[model samples]
Target: MTLIPRGFTLIEMVIVLVIIGVLAVFAMPDLSVAAIRGQIKESGPLLDVAKQGVVQGYGALGKFPANNIEAGIPEPTKMVGKYVTRVDVKDGAVNITWGNSVNGSIKDKVLTLRPAYVDGQPAVPITWVCAAAPVPKGMVLTGVDATDMLAKYVPLECQARAATAP
Candidate 1:
């Protein structure tokens, strides 16, 4: 009886492995972008929660929070495993900077939240800025305008704050 080859040859196996490696290299960039997008989406909601806390604290004390410590929310907390290094309220806005160690470098992102009135209604706009390395060249960080971005996401109570503000 004649013996027949039952599996791929050594060369065929090497070629298959090489193809997989090439495909992985091409796919890695897409995966990274997807991850960043997810992070960006998550950031908006967290800022909303924190902003609500700020408004609540302000309503109770008759002033905006002096700092994240006084904002009535946990500080230095992790959002999706990334450390939120700082949050500050300034000029009727909240600024949040967060970072995480990735591949030996600290990747950081900044978000700015502002209270504004839209369509005769109050709203909060949150802008995201990424300062991490390996970012695309000439990638502008200017966030969307406060009025445009926050019109849909702002909470009802936060919207009232703008109306009540002198």
Candidate 2:
């Protein structure tokens, strides 16, 4: 009687690799999306920094910082951690610009934080309304605004502000 070979054949190995390759192809997009979500979550603290800068500036200078420079927020050309790009303060609103590191759809969009200072007095509990910057170029969007597109990602307080837009 002849001894039977038990090792997997080269053909079987190749087939298994191909299956794995196909599975990876299907899984890649989901992984990318999860990564983007993580990145978004990480941005919360960065945004808080911007908010703190504005609030402190208002408290000390008796008004909002004229621009990002006055607010002490550096304008970044590239992504840093969850903050994709620069943090701008203008007109009592702090705008955080997203860079290429963000997901394709939401990339380059701006998240604006408007601190409620009625009559130049800081509101108790420091109320802030989140807003969206104007849409950027190359996005073939119509009828809907940036706030609408980014609604899912925006914080709850900002969602109400976006919805009330005239």
Candidate 3:
């Protein structure tokens, strides 16, 4: 009695593998960016909480915290679950270091924020300005890189740097 074959042929298996490989090659970059974006989203609320803390401190004490610790934020030595690795406050600026979950293009980037001072007060409520750099006089980060996740993910308060003169 002859038994009928029930398994795929070697060529069929090879074709399936090649198809999967091609699909993976195309899907990988998007998946990576999406994963990083998810992580960044998670950090957003936490950052807001920290910012609120600073505002609250200012309201109660009549000044921004001298540092993160004073603001009740602990300085991070490493990333906490694909989010911020560090939080720092100085000279009215808040700086956050990105975690490893971010893509290499912007991983470990330091985002700087400062409460906009309108008439010597921190705006009517609070308006944060995203500094392009760490310095107080740095330009705002705005529509800088269309492909840069860091620039894309930045909050609305920030503006991309202006194009340089040729």
Tens digit of per-residue lDDT, candidate 3, span 22-58: 9999998777666655666577666675677667766
RMSD of 3: 8.8
lDDT of 1 at 68: 57
List of clashing residue pairs for candidate 1: none
In order, how many clashes per candidate?
0, 0, 4
Task: Point to the candidate with the largest lDDT.
Answer: 2
Against the unseen true structure, what C-alpha lDDT does each candidate score? 0.47, 0.59, 0.58
Candidate scoring better on lDDT of 1 and 2 = 2
> What tens digits encode model 2's per-residue C-alpha lDDT throughout 1-166?
9989899999999999999999999998767656655666578777676667766776677766776666666653422555467666675566667764677756777766665533533443345666553322322111112232355655544555422111
lDDT of 3 at 31: 71
Better of 1 and 2 by TM-score: 2
Residue 154's C-alpha lDDT in candidate 1?
28
TM-score of each: 0.48, 0.56, 0.55
Q: Tens-digit lDDT track for model 1 on 1-166?
A: 9999999999999999999999999998666655544544455566666667666655566555665566676663432334345555553356665555322121444445554322222233322222221212332222222232222222233333322222
**TM-score of model number 2:** 0.56
